[model samples]
Target: MGRSFFRRDPATVARELLGCAMLHCCDGEWLGGWIVETEAYLAEGDPACHAARGRGRSNASMFEPAGTLYVYPIHAKHCVNLVTENAGVGSAVLIRAIEPVWGIDAMMQNRNVSDLRRVTSGPGMICSAMGIDRASDAMDVTRADDWLLTGGHQVADRVTQTPRIGVSRAADLRLRFFVDGNRFVSGLAREHTRPRRDVLGPDKDPSR
Candidate 1:
């Protein structure tokens, strides 16, 4: 992904990330996953955004340049974020779910799950499965030097948006986006943000 890909508003960027591949190099082995669900957090106005209060220890990455990773933990579990918009703008796209595509065996082993969907279906699941941590907090996602990667794929009318889950403030905002019908997408099926035109089936690996 280029810096321009994340230069837009967090909501638009979140929706656009559907079907994009997250390339990871872990333990000297290449691993990949396709993004299926995302949630937008805006610093300027969103109460749920970590930057709502201002730049601090937890949200420092959110104030960094575009294409940076803003990873943090929630409920003692991890969730990976893509820092977007301008520096100090404090906007990020929360990668809420993904469909495991490459290094399936390693992902399965890391997650301790034989089922593919369960391996990286949720934010915490994908973070743990991907080995993302503070060490990668500010990694440039556009890098190809065996670090992070964001690759595009076809995602037409399969996207559905809804309110972000597990947050009390700004809970009703329809900012969550997902590839409809993707089995790896977390959350209730009935709570889809909007009506679906067609459900994009299983995820396919996007080649570099």
Candidate 2:
């Protein structure tokens, strides 16, 4: 996938990113996995977004061009996001979870865990497993040789949407997207059950 693939609404990119391979080359070795879960943060009216308070030193990357990496720290761990829309847009898609597929041994070693389910299962884990941190912020994956995002496998009916986790504001907004029945997804059981649209009624559209 190229920059154009991400030059759209953050919600669309988040939903369509499922099953895509995210690879990061480090020290001649590649580490990554299939994206299984993501959350979209809008540039406006999204109180949970980092750019909600206005762009600054820490969130400048979120305002960069599409395909930019906006890595941030939370609770001593890091999370990686892909900037979306045209330049100046603060919207981005957070890669919440991934299914380990490449460099499993390296990922496990980095995470200091032996269980496959624990590796790259969440946003913080994915950053640790892939050696991503503040240094990766603002890097354009669309043009970088070390970072690559390949075309994804369409999940279609298997895709589910739910309220984003770990956010107090806008908690009712169902902006999180994940592959149903995927063991790699990180969240409570209810989050993986069914799409929120089934219960939120047709009047509500969180994708906006």
Candidate 3:
């Protein structure tokens, strides 16, 4: 076993976590995935981060020491991400995407779909498959009980950085990072844009 995934610096941690593995223990089975994408949320005054508005009960994990799990819900449809960083310091790195590695059967079962593309790829889907929720937030990632971030083979290729997704205020912040050619990455990247046919439907008028 290696050291915990909790890092004191969010930016440094985000970059380092790229090729690490996230493990989940469920019902005597072990489920794991490779971290393919991530985003760093800096402390207060960082317009792109949740803690930028100051600490509160909901985001208390942001202040805790690194290696703490910061899980939370977003848009009422997804359990967005987990933050890893120092406690009570408002620094965290969000796990944005993953590539399933261990216990594929159980991951598929948890996701309730068979399509590999839809399982354990996006942040919310990864959370759903790993049994993470608001209740799991702030949990210790170094613990053996439920979730853990473990050391794995380091990523050798250069990572690509992009603007954070789905936010209006910090949309310009290039905090999101991902492996250059990973297909398991979420559709939020620039290359993952919807097909032009979908954007301009067959019957839709071009001037709208």
Candidate 4:
């Protein structure tokens, strides 16, 4: 995908990224997988977003150009997001989960786990699996030779949208998207179920 692919609404990018692949080349070894789940964080009225309070030393990457890597530390681990829209806009798409496809051994080694299912199953695990950290923050994945996002698989019909999990504020807004029935998805069965359009439409204002 090009820079234009990420220069859009965070929710739209989150939904469309369900089947995309995020690959990172580290020390001549490739590590990555097909994206299985994601959550969109908007610049407007989303208090759960890191940039909701405006850019700071920790969240400065969130204010970078679209396609930039926004890595933030949380609970002693790190979560990665792709900055969306134009520069100075704080919106981003958080990659919640991925199905390991390439460099499984390296991913397992990075995560220090033997179970394949445990690898790259959540946001923090993804960062550990791919060796992503604060050092990668603000790097433009679109232009980087080491970091690449590719069209991995087609899963339009298999997509499911629901309210974002693990967020206290704006948790009812349907901003989370994932591939239905993909084992790599981190959310539980109830969490991944698509909500009724009339109840909370996919594009409903998250502030509500």
TM-scores of all candidate predictions against the true structure: 0.90, 0.91, 0.82, 0.90
lDDT of 4 at 135: 88
Q: Which portions of model 2 miss their true places by more than 4 Å?
A: 193-208
Higher-ranked by lDDT: 2 or 4 = 2
TM match of model 1 to true structure:
0.90
The 0-to-1 C-alpha lDDT of every candidate, in the order given, reads: 0.81, 0.86, 0.68, 0.85
Q: Which residue pairs collide, candidate 1?
A: none
What is candidate 4's lDDT per residue for 41-71, written digit by digit as tens? 9999899998989889989989999999999
* TM-score of predicted structure 4: 0.90
Error of 4 at 178 (Å): 0.3
Give the Å error, residue 38, model 1.
0.3
What tens-digit string does per-residue lDDT give for candidate 3 at 126-159? 8878767777777666654666565565565547
Per-residue lDDT of candidate 2, residues 86-168 (tens digit): 99979999999888777889999999999988998899999999999999999999899888888556676789899999899
User: Which rank order by lDDT, best down to worst?
Assistant: 2, 4, 1, 3
Best by lDDT: 2
lDDT of 1 at 173: 91
Q: Which pairs clash inside model 2?
A: none
Quote the lDDT for 120 in model 4: 93
lDDT of 1: 0.81
Q: Write the per-residue lDDT of candidate 1 for residues 1-208, one digit (tens) a residue.
A: 7889998899989998998788788898767677889999987768999989988987798998899999887787788899889988999999988777788899889888888778888889988788777788887877647665555568758788788989899999999998877777889867654542333443544444
